[model samples]
Target: MQPYCKLKSSTRSLSKLVACSALLLLLDLSRCFSHHTYEWQDSHTNERLVCKQCPPGTFVSQHCTRDSPTICKQCPKLHYTEYWNYLESCLYCNVFCNFLEEEAQPCNSTQNRACQCKPGYHAELDFCIEHSSCPPGSGVAQLGNPQQDTKCSQCPQGTFSSVSSMDPCRNHQNCSAQHLEVNVPGNRFHDTFCTACKISKGSEASDGLEDGSGSEDCQDAVIDFVPYEIRVPRRLRRLKRIVSRSSQSSKRDRKSLEELQMELHTYLVQLKNTEKKELLLMFITAGIVSQSEVAPFQISAGKESLQVRRK
Candidate 1:
């Protein structure tokens, strides 16, 4: 009877253990099912509904009901969502290429337009501005890019620029006029200045006496007018005549003609300088030169010269 009692007690303990294991397995299965069911619940609605998320490039047109799936529509023109969303309407694309800006990329259902600065303009902060040019006496320190403006710096000593551009400053010209000495050293902002020699007349005379030359002979003659002013127009006229006569000149002569053209250009620069100085002097003396008279003076370069015409 004791052995039978012991076997019956072991059987009861095994049955209780089996019942507990079954209950734990059922509890796990129920929890998993509940999680799966609630995963797609709509949070905005009072009555929670199982709703699938709208895909990218689309927006929800209608909410999911108990028996229906979420209704979605493709984003309209110039509209985009980019990512999956539960939004009721598509987002409007706000990017636009204005007058100074250009379209880098066109708008699509999934993305907004991309913009950049147009040619001759550069982006600064949030907007576009006209590209800057290095003015005369300055040079481009840094080139302009799509996103940045051109940077300019003052030309260093012994160099200069005469026009507004992106070019580097050029070296100052040496004094070439006879019997003249440099009065002022050139800087980045101004040209090298030249003037007559400042040695005393008595010193020059003494030097001449030592060399057995007269005082008058020792002194260099001061020019009344710039040689370039008198010579350039005549040279230009001569070149034009040559060009007219050279219609039959061979291609081999073209090289010589180009050399002449370069020479002419140098002369023209000198003439321009002379004229500029003269005009400045006239302004200082007379305050103003009549525009009509100035026009005629420019046209009749050889026949009419600038004179103090009292009227």
Candidate 2:
């Protein structure tokens, strides 16, 4: 019922009389209800009553009555209520993730379950497929994630992809830039194969050779157990001899192999043009280190790896 207010004083100002009635009307509203409530007509008394809404995770089991308040009940398992509601029953969980999909967020009293693709897979219409493997001569343009698939692209010129993998196109080994002779040029499928010891043309002329020809033979190189005739450079011969002599597994021996290999590698890297030893012995495959640099490993036998050729 509305509150009654009568400003009977003739001495009272017009603003004061309006304020008195407004205050009494606000008091009547406070006595009825506040936020998060609704008015309903009581079936027994035929009177309107304001009832509070049930909080999240619970629902109104019965409406407000003249003698009793609105009755609320807790949601059962696998059911949920998001906010203050007068719903009779909580919502049921109907969504389910598939085999290839993983639950990103578990279902709770307030939120629904969310799913996404697992690792190495990407989401499609309703399911997920495995990420694409970049084929030989092709490469991954973009890496795949939970929502997107791996993008593939063909290897461009001067680059190659030798394996079926997710990696991108690898820059081909630049033999000319490394000051080495290119025996087999690089394509999209394979990398440039460079000579093991000998340097290519155009290098010696830069070093004051009148008519530069990189083909210079060596009499000191030898044939070894490997298919290629491994040749030690003139600068590295001393270190190779020392490593060959060390038989005991001492601290000196531990450092000897590493030092010898490093010295040999440094000499080969620095040895350009005329300084580079040309393949003298007519071996089908010739290399100072190993023929296949892709699978290059240390030759443990220092003596056999660097034995001097006899006269």
Candidate 3:
């Protein structure tokens, strides 16, 4: 019984000693954190004392001793110390701005270099990506900045975005205001295409301007952007005077020219009487061909339908 009692007392003392040691260790850690200490021990007396940390933009010139505090000196140019530290040297400004990046913040004693993506580009992860353009049927909802990507939205009804760009959608054209017929209706991707109806006597569409200038052009119809070479023959050579140039012209010049002529002849055959009159007038005005040069064809002018013969 005596031996058991002694063993129990020894166990209790050991447990108490362990608890005290743990409490002391926790208190030491809390004190170090609250005061931000760098504790140093004297080798001879085993005495420990806290050393002061250098502030930002500075470094420790010398460590603390028994009688003196930590010696500090301001960091040199191009060196940085962001926080209170006992570091022997400051860090270098290693970040550099590339072509796709711009300097947002220059390197200083307390901070390092900072970079951002250039205009028309947005940062993603570690790289800069060019802003994406909206498609034909869509438009830009929100433009992008250095930190984000471009946002796009579908074009709404009665509006159209004909081209892929960062611009917003535009309203469709009003055909009635132009005194024309809606040949093709507008949607999200394309504007309304208009065409001219035949001008009859006492018709509403024929009420032209007082200057009498509305009959010639089909009432300002949307004519395609035809190239000069495609619309008129070039006066380069004998072949050029007949038809425009093509890729196969070099290999089979005469045959291709004849084929192009046949195609033009077919188109002319398909044109309406009013269109034929307009074509003849255009040719006469532009000096491309003469009235006598044209073959036999029928045309209509205002109230009269006239037939022309080669003369």
Candidate 4:
């Protein structure tokens, strides 16, 4: 009986030791899981591990094992990881700005590079374009900024602009109402050109006509010289008197009269070749005719009659 009692006491002691070992193992597992650690099994070694998360701006190079801690590395230049991750490699941060654009902010481990349009350039959809300049006869309605294009508007009446630029149009010159005539009319791109009115001698004031007293004799001579339309002004009528009085003049005056006659002959030849009645009328109205001797002139065009008398 003493030998059987010793065997039973030894068996009870072995069972108690086994229960205590199991309880200690469960406590260790609960403590590990409660601390936010996760277990990962290795495929090659079949070993379990508790892995810690990688910090920001770094990536996990190797997972943790039961015997070793997790391995991590900082992200290289031009690479980034914005948050804690278990990725094996960092993301590339090599974004580039296009033409007409510039880098506003450089890339770093935590953020990407920012881009913006350059000066004198505006954003248009996905690209950039240069600002537009206002053209002649127009003004800049709105100036351009870095993010927007320029706006233009036409110049109003009494204003003019001659060149393309960002400046506003200028006001046109106003002609005097009394003595000046509008030689060239005002336009959006050019100012008005004015000329003084021609005053006549004696009692009658010929506003545009040249001074002449011997007009009837020249009228008869012109009728015999040309059959076609020749609207001669009063100044041209005086040329007949120059020819009639040339023989009575001195040697110097005769030489001057001859040169004048040659110039008139050349002009008449050009007028005949061109046969431009409107050009001849403009010469008559603008007082371009000379008071010198004219050669025999003949022009033939349609049935338009010649008016030698000045209005």
TM-scores of all candidate predictions against the true structure: 0.41, 0.46, 0.56, 0.36
User: What is each predicted model's overall lDDT from 0 to 1?
Assistant: 0.53, 0.56, 0.60, 0.54
Model 1: lDDT of residue 44: 59
Model 3 bad stretches (over 4 Å) = 1-31, 41-47, 173-183, 193-311
Error of 2 at 112 (Å): 2.5
Residue lDDT tens for model 1, 142-208: 8887789989998987798756787778888687655565433565644554544332212111122
> Best by lDDT, which number?
3
Q: Residue by residue across 228-261, what tens digits does model 2's lDDT show?
A: 2233333234434432343333334433332343
Worst 10 residues of 2 by lDDT: 202-211
Q: Tell me how candidate 4 scores on lDDT.
A: 0.54
lDDT ranking, best first: 3, 2, 4, 1
Question: Pick by TM-score: which candidate is best?
Answer: 3
Off by over 4 Å in 1: 1-46, 49-52, 62-72, 124-127, 156-159, 170-187, 190-311
- Give lDDT: candidate 1, residue 252: 39
Which residue runs does candidate 2 get wrong by more than 4 Å? 1-51, 66-71, 136-138, 153-158, 174-179, 197-311
